[model samples]
Target: MRKFIVAFFMLAVLVSLVSCEQKESQVVDRKAEMKTSIDSLESVLKAAEGDLDEDLGLQMIDAYVGYAKEFEADTASVIYWYKAGEIAQNIPGKELYAVTYFANIFEDHPNHALAPQSVFLSGVAFDKMGDKERAAVSFEHFLEAYPSHDWAPDAQAMLQMSTDTTDLDTQVKAWLENANKTQE
Candidate 1:
């Protein structure tokens, strides 16, 4: 009876070990599946960059919008948004879209190293949209918040330009002309 009892105990221990291992394997499989999904999404976004289809590009951009929150505290995503802002601003009627990207980096990731640049780009996008008052406000906020930042000088210059002229319409016209020259 003693020998039989010892065998039973040993069998129980072996079964428990197997069960633990199976659970570990299941967890690893889940992790791999999640990684695969993220990678697939990234690949689709990258490929969409060169796609001539606006619908596909916009779809990818919308998909990336979901990942924007995931990018919180991630400096790389800040840079990515900054670049996306640059691209979106260049496309006519997309300035507001670009504003959203820049605002994400500036507001959600304020302490990020790229936050100042992100704010500056936000102002630039606003300016491109002919919203001088809002642009001035954005630039002014960046200057006051990050006075020592590398982009501070540019922001300050933009702020001065934004305020120097009394006529809003004239400033708007000049800004558009300058923007056209850059686009060309």
Candidate 2:
């Protein structure tokens, strides 16, 4: 009876050790995959810095979109979604997808540091896509959710500006340009 009990104890210990090792391995693998995705994205962004061809830009945007979906639970998803939104802005008539990407960051990771910016950008994306109603809604949601955020004032302004009938795109573009400059 004693030998049998000892054998069972040893098997349980072995199983526990194996389980721990497997979990550790999974974490390492996930980290490695995230690093690879980030590196690839950096490469694509660098290639896009000078003389970016439309075809290549589209391909890169597609990749970033895929990364955003695949890494949704990962914090790096915020970066992937943000990059996807920025890249999608260059593509004609694809502004809605950028809005979706920005919305994903805010919806899935509301506590993330980038969530407030994502909310504001989603409003801009909707405005650029010519959906004033949705843009207003997004801006309102941003204000409600992040009233103390630095972008709250801008969000309020955007909500009001989205009501205008003339040159909305120009206004939004100017606001985004100014925001970018301020960030720099």
Q: lDDT by residue for model 2 over 91-160, one digit each (tens)?
A: 7787888888887788888998888888888788888887899999989999999999988889998999
Quick one: best TM-score, which candidate? 2
The number of residue pairs in model 2 that clash at the backbone is: 0
| Alpha-carbon lDDT of model 2 | 0.80
lDDT of the candidates, in the order given: 0.75, 0.80
What range of 10 consecutive residues in model 1 has the weakest lDDT sum? 66-75
lDDT of 1 by residue, 62-170 (tens): 5455444553444445665765676677677889988888888877878887788878888888888888888899999998889988888899888887768558798
| Candidate 1 stretches greater than 4 Å from native | 1-60, 69-77, 166-184
Model 2 ranges with Cα > 4 A deviation: 50-73, 147-149, 166-184
How much does candidate 1 score in TM-score? 0.57
Clashes of each: 0, 0
